[model samples]
Target: MPKGYEMLPNGIIRIKSDNSMYDPWEIKKSQLDGEELTLIGRVVWAEQKM
Candidate 1:
């Protein structure tokens, strides 16, 4: 885990390209095209915690 990233719970990731869905190929914290997506099931972080 990074300094500002946490694990996701029951989350689903989706890969996108040009603002479009890539396909059924989703993933976890990773880097694509030299970019660190830092995704946990497509979730960067918990935007809202209620």
Candidate 2:
């Protein structure tokens, strides 16, 4: 993560469990390389709150 990098539109980020855990909302920037494009996690359905 850097200071002024923008997140890719419709782009999903997957970080390894070995990496540090962070809230998705807290990720304002990222430093992704082409080799690190592999997905480390999958997103399922989100629960609806009433």
Estimate every model's Cα lDDT from 0 to 1. Answer: 0.42, 0.38
The candidate that wins on TM-score is 1
TM-score of each: 0.22, 0.18
Model 2: how far residue 48 lies from native, Å: 2.2
Candidate 2 per-residue lDDT over residues 1-50, each given as its tens digit: 21122345556442334324543332312444444443344544456789
lDDT of 1 by residue, 1-50 (tens): 22223345544345444323343355454434445554344435555678
lDDT of 2: 0.38
Model 1 / residue 19 / CA error / Å: 7.7
List candidate 1 segments past 4 Å from native: 1-9, 19-24, 28-50
